[model samples]
Target: MNLYYSFGTVLLLLAITAPTALLFGYGGAMATRSGVAPLRWFGKSYIAIVRGVPDIAFFLFFVIALDQGFEYLRHKIKCPDWNEPIRQGSDFVVCTAAKLPLGNAPQWQHETYGFMLAVLTFAIVFGAFAGNVLFGAMRAVPKAQLETAEAYGMTRRQVTRRVLIPQMWVYALPGLSNLWMVLIKATPLLFLLGVEDIVYWARELGGTKTPNFTAYPHGDWRMWYFLGLLVFYLAFTKLSEVVLSRIMARLTHGQATAGGEAQRKAAA
Candidate 1:
């Protein structure tokens, strides 16, 4: 039962993370393309720094730091009476109320808290990659169309909304499709965040069980479990490729890119 639930956990993480990450990427891309210098620099820096860091290192470090940072803030607010230092010769201390799930939290609460952290971490990491793809897509928009919009007395914002936004997707879809595939592959990293995802279950349930632990003690079956996982991922990505290709065709139907050119030639 737990193993079955782990499959849903993987899908749920993808469903939530994909849109949230896209929102982050969109914001970052827009900032990098903005007229304001600081905003542009911030966007570029976020994309470069996060994307450059190895995923496992980021997962190990960021989750702990973010968890501690939250507890520290809560400790200051909820345990002001304490005079002891938070850092006690290397061991960090915080009030019971400051614990994210509370010390006596139910098992489900702890799992939920861990899952939330995983989602946020995934979003932050993948969003940077998505932003880079989108930034390049934004630049890939032809200068001629933008200049034409300017000459037509269109404001920068208007040109962005009317022409730039709509057209960039044609160029962006291929990169974004690859990013989506990468995101699917990265889902196994949920284990690092302490979330019991499919990979975790495969290893756990497939391991040999002692007679004391269960009546149905069995030999190691990890290979079969992992093979099932391989099939699941391959099928999912194959379907995604088909769907994304269709979307790409739709986006490029009348545009001026190579995909569009091929599409027009096919129609003719």
Candidate 2:
């Protein structure tokens, strides 16, 4: 029941997180490589700080900080009349309207809010790695190719779009493939965010007490539950490898890379 549904939850989180993270990564990489000093510094700081932190620590702290930051801003806007400080001896109180998803929000709204936060946390963490990979990939595009595009009177932006981006993918795919696998493995962190994902259900159901614990009164079946997770992850990664390998081949087709050379040889 819940376990089955949680499988979809895990899948949905990944489906949303992957592209969002890539967008973040792409932006971060672009910023790092920007001509403007401010943009480059911002990008460098984001990559350095985010990548330097432990993922779990970032997840735990950032969610709380982000949630509070939102509420604080909303409190200033929506609860302007309030005279009391938001921080009072370890209690941060705010107006009802300021609460995310609202205090009286439906159960589904609460769950959805948590899920969104989890998605954001995952994206920000993984995107740094993706940014580093993409930045290197962008640089890996041959300087001569970019120079040729410029010699044809192409603007920097035009050269980037026509020459750099088109070719960077070949270099980027290998790193991105590895990042995708890492993202898959990192999905279980959803549990720490109180998302009631597959891992959460597994622990609850496998526990000795009741939450389905009473119904079955099962004795410590966590081993079996986790074993199933092991299988799911292994199979999923294997499938992902096949898919990404095909993508790499496509990107490398007729290019100057070793992969393209090998394909050309095989065809000959």
Candidate 3:
């Protein structure tokens, strides 16, 4: 049952992470193309820096850094009177009140806090990649379309909203679809984020001797549990592929792209 619940955790993370990442990506892409130099630099730097880092290193380092940052802010706010240095050799000390999901908090609170952090980390990392894809997609929109919109007396904002935004999706969908698959595969990394996801539960429950010494001691069932995970992921990827294909087809329909040409020919 715990294993079953953990599977749900994986799904929930993906559900939450996907849209959040896309939102972040949209902002980053817009920033990259902004007329303001600072905004453009920030967007470019965000994409370059995040994409250049190894994901595992970023995951390990960013979570700790983010947690500490939160705790530090809380410590200052909640314990301004305390004089002890927060950094003592290798340890980070803070007031009890500063602890997120405080030391005395329930198990669920700690888990929830960790899950939220994991979600944020995933969004930030994947958003960079999505932003790059979207940046390209935005540029791929026909310049003539923008000119035509302007010729019709549309404002730049109106041209973006009505012409550029609508057309870029056709170019963006393929790259975004690939990113979605990568994100799906990356869900197992949740275990490293301290989330008791399916992978963690699989290893924990699949061991020969249970931590509490189960009545039925089965030898190394890790293989079976992992096999189940494999099947689950495979089915998930296949479903995603089918859905993305349909989406691509829909987006391509009547567009100026080759996909649209082929689609039109098929209908004829």
Candidate 4:
């Protein structure tokens, strides 16, 4: 059923968005800690701005801004002759050639484009939070470890790659775990991004009245449908907690943190 398929849609979004966000966050975190002043400023500004703004507002505005931005650039390249203002009142018009999916593209293409936008929006928003977490985690690594690495003739880059990067994750795991839960809860926002995620399908299929023409009509069942979604999310979070707990245990083993200390005591 369409509703069942929407479940996959939500999962696919998570699969794509998680790594992409982590990649963006890693870059931002590295930039924040970079020796170059401008890169550091840019990274700090990115984290502050994105994390400060309300996520719903960003979701509502950024998708349109990004889509229009792409169109504007394409218009310049594809429609140099058309001199009409792109901001004619509230409408954004562009040449047919400049249309993102093209005017006559299939329905799937339009849906794909919308899904991509939703994924990018999620990545950018969550990435800022991840960057902040990572930045703190990097600082939390013991300075003495870095000193020891340097004493052994390791270069700064070598120290970072071999020592800092490996150890920071133990500190960062808790924050990243929380972020993952937040990301799971935020999947319903795909509806706002024009992606027909589970929430959308739930509403559409659970309504009491059928459309003007429909094969099946039912009583008001939106409550039951939403209840199912609640269960789905609850199970997902529970599973995540189990998996993250295992990961934390594994990562903390033999490290100097409290988790590692506890793990060592248990093994002994």
- How do all models score by TM-score? 0.93, 0.95, 0.94, 0.95
Name model 4 segments beyond 4 Å from true. Answer: 210-212
Q: Clashing residue pairs, candidate 2? A: none
Deviation from native of the Cα of residue 109 in model 1, angstroms: 1.4
Q: Over the stretch 1-268, how does candidate 4's per-residue lDDT look in tens digits? A: 9999999999999999999999999999999999999999999999999987889998998899899989999999989999888888977889889999898999999999999999999999999999999999999998999999999999989999999999898899999999999999999999999999899999988888766557786788999999999999999999999999999888887887787888889889
Ranking by lDDT: 4, 3, 2, 1
Candidate 1 Cα outliers beyond 4 Å, as residue runs: none
Q: Looking at model 4, which ten-residue stretch has the lowest summed lDDT?
A: 209-218
Tens-digit lDDT track of model 2 for 91-202 = 9999898999798888999999888888988888888889999999999988999999999999999998999998898889899999999999999988999899999988
Clashes within 3 Å, all models in order: 0, 0, 0, 0
Q: Model 2 misses residue 86 by how many Å?
A: 1.7
Candidate 1 has its poorest 10 consecutive residues by lDDT at: 251-260
Q: Write the residue-wise lDDT of candidate 1 on 40-118 in tens digits.
A: 9999899999977797898888788888988999999999998888899979889888989898989999988888888
Candidate 3, run of 10 with poorest lDDT = 209-218
Please give me the total number of clashing residue pairs in predicted model 3. 0
- The TM-score obtained by model 2 is 0.95
Local lDDT at 11 for model 1: 92
Pairs of residues clashing in candidate 3? none
Task: Give the lDDT of residue 266 in candidate 1.
Answer: 89
Cα-based lDDT for every prediction: 0.90, 0.91, 0.92, 0.93
lDDT of 1: 0.90
